[model samples]
Target chain A: EPEVTQTPSHQVTQMGQEVILRCVPISNHLYFYWYRQILGQKVEFLVSFYNNEISEKSEIFDDQFSVERPDGSNFTLKIRSTKLEDSAMYFCASRGPTEIHYEQYFGPGTRLTVT
Target chain B: SQQGEEDPQALSIQEGENATMNCSYKTSINNLQWYRQNSGRGLVHLILIRSNEREKHSGRLRVTLDTSKKSSSLLITASRAADTASYFCATYVMGFQKLVFGTGTRLLVSP
Candidate 1:
């Protein structure tokens, strides 16, 4: 079965540096999303994208965060500046074209560690 | 006590036993989904139950949704040690495009 795949399984960066987490969602899926989970915390939604634009975002997805579909298959999340609290497992997910009652397939996730 | 919360945060059982996890949500949802995550790894989709449906089953996994009560349960029967993982319930709320995830239940199935 086709699955969502992410690059740089583990990333380490300085507190003030920028980092880009990349994902290649299933080729035919229509909706893409980004979520994060702090160690021992529930998965939190960051942003959702569709039709080449952001559909919705959470408070945590402030100015520092941006997502883009730079290419047909690549969906990336860029953090302008990383904070210690930003360290977490970032996951990318994609859902099929069906309008409703579809499950989102998740990638293995990129573990971001900011020091 | 957030949008989605799972009860009995941790559960332990032996192989061949059954495991049940429950989830409660605060708002009206379009659908409820169950996912599993191994230690420090990615999440794997398990099953999905729509708000309009009362129950769904896939393999040995069974899920039931009670829209009126805003609750859902996931049951894994005749489980194996490989079933040991953290299980989470995610809700796609009405009018929202994002999925809200629960705190998750860590299941440890010993051999």
Candidate 2:
């Protein structure tokens, strides 16, 4: 089955450096999302992208965070200045055209470590 | 906060036994979904029960949703050692377009 894939399975960055997490959602998917899991905690939604614009975002997704679909298959999340709290597993997910059922496919996730 | 809570922070069962996890949500939702995550890995979609539907089954997995009570349960029967993982319930809201995940139930099926 086709699945969402993310690049840089693991990353280590300085506290004030920039990091870009990349994902390639399923080719036909229209809705894309970014979420983070802090260590063993529950997953938290960051932002959702559809129709080339942000549909919704959480308070956790502040000015430091931005998402871009620079190409047809590539969706990227960039953090301007990483904080210690930014060390977490960042996941990328995608869903098909239907909006009601809301079934999503998640990628393996990129583990971001800020020091 | 994405509105769902799960209990039994951890559970242990032997292979061939059954495992059940429960989830409770605070508000109305379009559907409730169950997902599994291995240690330090991404999530895998398991099952979805719509607010209008009462129960659903896939393989040895069964899910029931009680919209009126705002709770749901997932049962895994005749489980295997490989079933050891953290199970999460996510609540889906309409126009907000988000899936808020619960704390999750960690199941350890020993061989």
lDDT of 2 by residue, B5-84 (tens): 89778999999999999899988888899999999899999999888999999999999999888899999999999999
TM-score against truth, every candidate: 0.98, 0.98
Best by DockQ: 2
Worst 10 residues of 1 chain B by lDDT: B1-10
Error of 1 at A108 (Å): 0.5
Per-residue CA lDDT of model 2 for A1-115, tens digit only, reads 9999999999999999999999999998899999999998899999999999999999999999999999999999999999999999999999986665388999999999999
C-alpha lDDT (0 to 100) for residue A97 of candidate 2 = 66
Off by over 4 Å in 2: none
lDDT of 1 by residue, B1-111 (tens): 788899889999999999999999999999999999999999999998888899999999999999888999999999999999999999999999988999999999999
Quick one: best TM-score, which candidate? Answer: 1
User: What DockQ results do all the predictions give, each relative to the true complex?
Assistant: 0.93, 0.94
TM-score of chain B of each: 0.98, 0.96
- For the record, the alpha-carbon RMSD of candidate 2 to the native fold, in angstroms, is 1.1
